[model samples]
Target: MTQIVQSLAEISKPYDALFCDLWGCLHNGVAPFPEAVAALQAFRASGGKVVLLTNAPRPAKFVIESLERMGCPKDAYDLVVSSGDAAQDAMFAGAVGRKVWHLGPSKDDGFFTEIPAEWQGQADIERVDFDDAEGIVCTGPFDEINEVPEDYRAKFLLAKMRDLPMLCANPDVVVDMGDKRIYCAGALAVLYEDMGGEAMYFGKPHPPIYDMARRKLAAIGGVEDGRILAIGDGINTDVPGAAGEGIDCLFVTGGLAHDQFGADQKNPDPELVRAWLGARQTDPRYTIGTLR
Candidate 1:
């Protein structure tokens, strides 16, 4: 019974707030999607409060700068809420006495800008001093473009050997970068968990990030969750995360799981799309090939 719409303009008026995902919905990492940007502008012009909610492991400031670099104008949305922003409050308190090793690209060093954790080590692809560390904090792969999950085998093995717990900042296993898909921190975290290491996720599909987004929405005078709409490309993260917060979700089919359904921003195969959604056990209230 999901309504597959051609554009968000078809249903923008009913919602007071739009909790939009950043990666797949806005841009494919390389540049901003003009249609997606236009859609957001149109929605905001109609009196809708737009919040760019993302699972990016980097802090809000970093996300903002990156978006600006990628041609995302400031007027496209009102605010940016990131997983790193939500995870900052929990880092220091949770690290109580443990020496933590940060496992991610140098781009995510902003995470330590405020967290009061005893720094054990910060390595990209090299294995950290697991013997001295009690836990691992992963933001993403050292090289997102050319790296795969298998590259982290040695690192995960070391963590597993020491029984170190991992805190994953982003829960997306893979993110679309233009026409290519790249592995993310969540993929490394999942690998460690599969290797018998305890992994804690701090991004979408988890409650804390959504809690932060909802708070932002409320501050903008959009208190009723029913009046808000969440839009994203990931069924695993966006749909489930919004539904858990009692908000309606509009799934974007072209960005992440497009290959599975042979879909694109301009064209979508309905039967294949339906089968994929059914297999995933997610029922988004609306579906679109793109945000437009």
Candidate 2:
């Protein structure tokens, strides 16, 4: 059984660092949650380091910019590690070949242009037409607000026939953008796999992102795995990622699964939370209605 808590400070003493998710845990894609920001700031003030472990399909630099734009104070987190950076490493390493079809919006152009300084001078990655491509690199649906995964079934079937592997950048199936819910790259990837197309992931609940998170943490000041707590609203991505890495998890229930937990965002029904977890077969060490 998972312990239900009201705030992060209740369990902060035992942890040295936090692998915090950004989407529903911190901001809702439109603005910052004041309480979540303050909680992270307080944790850092108490000598805890915070790594913004995100599944955003853009590079860490772009993620930082997004945070800055959203007024997420810089003092809250020490580092930002994104699935884009990890996926870029694999894409550059020839995971999905050089010439691939790009399946995301214009915002994700940074994915192709923002090559790190170290990876400069590598073989060029080309974005070609779906019919002419060797593989697919999906950040998300071109229009997340209006498009569904089924919209691309025709293309995915063709890709399956050609046997072109897809490298998924963001593994989040859906995220709440303000009050509206939108599908992400993972939704499309799930659809692809359901249709017998190969879809590769480098985001949360996957080893690659965790490995990258560990490396990034080590570069600054490494925390023992036991002393690091994973914080997120994503049960599938955040909870399983922490469990697989043998670390504790703090599940923020007021995110995507908020409705199922209860009507109140701050006050969650414990029984409902447990039942939700049971349905998902996930067990987090702690649960909070929201980050604060």
Candidate 3:
């Protein structure tokens, strides 16, 4: 059974490096969670190295700016690694081809600013010339707050018809927006695959970003994979990603999947948490109601 703890202080001794997630664990897309921020600060105060690993489809600079805007203190993390930064290699190199169709919000336009590729905006997903396009890069939904995954059904069908491959910048299926859950780019990528289109993910639970995170960890005095603790809110991405890297994971109960485990920000049902973990065959080393 996963050890349930009230504070990360109870189990922070063994780990020297932390691969902590950003969105749900530290903030809810709008504001920073004070307890989570304190946990990371405490971990750092104890000489632990922190690498803020995120599946956010923007570069590290963009994420840092967002975190600062949300009032997440700078000292809480040592370095930031994002899937968008990892995908930049392919984005600039034209891994699929030069002509690409962008399938995300305009705010994320910075992703393609440095690259010299033709960007067919999200004007008409259904009518975009898929045959002429090399691939599609999805950072997020065109309208995350007002739309759902089902809204992209006809678009995915059209992409499938042309046998276009998609480069999914963020691998998160959904993120909690305060009390509501919003679909992410990964959800759209899955829908495209379900419609027989190829998809390439570049984030957590995938090797590329983990490889990048490991390099960052190595630069600041290396820690054994076993001694590095991975903490996050998502069972789908974080747990499996840590397990895939041979690192122990601390599952945060009050994050995105809290409702599934009958949990809230302040209290969580341990029995329900265990059942949910058991059902997924996930063996997280630790569990906490919130990051603190």
Candidate 4:
């Protein structure tokens, strides 16, 4: 457990490569954190490789587009590996000939864009209604999960009993999308699992995302597990995921955990920070604070 003064320059020195989390550490979903972005730019200028690893359900290209709109230059990081990309890859590898019924917004249909042309129509969930589907590839139903009617439970059970595997594109159960707690695919996957369905996750806190990040890091001459640095704000996903890979982690205090600890309240005391840090006792190497 190494606790430094929480300066990005100082903390970034020991590692030659950085696998950074996009949402909370680099930017809140809506806006870019100039200071954090500047730190990444500085790291890149100094010859360090930076890769943005996000749990966003969209593919890496889509995430890059979103970041660009938020003023995040493509050069800020060498490459990106999103949960959506991982999920799509898993789906293609596992279900080459099987039918997939995705339950998400129409915009998310792009996830199956890489499927073979012959399977494209069958791969598309929007074209065929849910009742005619063979399997489920859930990205997220957004607010629809809250109002899932009781009658739907039987249908979900039947799908599970048929051994229809579900791929959860986004493993984040919930995210602070602006000022609201929006549900993600992980929540729906959990529900399906509770109903005895087989579910595969492809995002943060899962090895596939980390494995993808590690491969990207290696492509750009990054260090091995012992020397890589993982920076993020979500403890449940980021901290645990990094620790599982035997990498060091830096936790940002201005993200979800901070809000959960009431650090956003008026006159938040240091005790809250202390308690939060104490709760994360299992994380091997960590520091807590804003990116200064």
Best by TM-score: 2
Candidate 3, residues 19-122, lDDT tens digits: the string is 99987888988899999899999999999999999999988888899999988999999999898877765666566556788889987877776332333442
TM-scores for every candidate against the unseen true structure: 0.91, 0.98, 0.91, 0.85
Compared with the true structure, model 4 gives a TM-score of 0.85
The global Cα lDDT (0 to 1) of model 3 is 0.84
- What order do you get sorting by lDDT, best first? 2, 3, 1, 4
**Candidate 1: worst 10 consecutive residues by lDDT?**
118-127
lDDT of 1 by residue, 1-292 (tens): 5778899999877788888999889998999989999999998898888999999998788999999898899989998998887766556556312467888888898887644233334322223455677778788888888988888898788878877878788999999888888898889988888888888876898998888887777787755787889999988899998888888999998878777767354567788878888887888999998888
* Model 2 Cα lDDT, one tens digit per residue, 1-292: 9999999999999999999999999999999999999999999999999999999999999999999999899999999999999999999988999999999999999999998887899899999998889999999999989999999999898999999999999999999999999999999999999999899999998999989999989999999999999999888899998999999999998998888877898888999989989988888999999998
Better of 2 and 3 by TM-score: 2
Residue 273, candidate 4: Cα error in Å is 3.3
Q: What is the lDDT of residue 164 in candidate 3?
A: 74
All candidates' lDDT scores? 0.82, 0.94, 0.84, 0.73
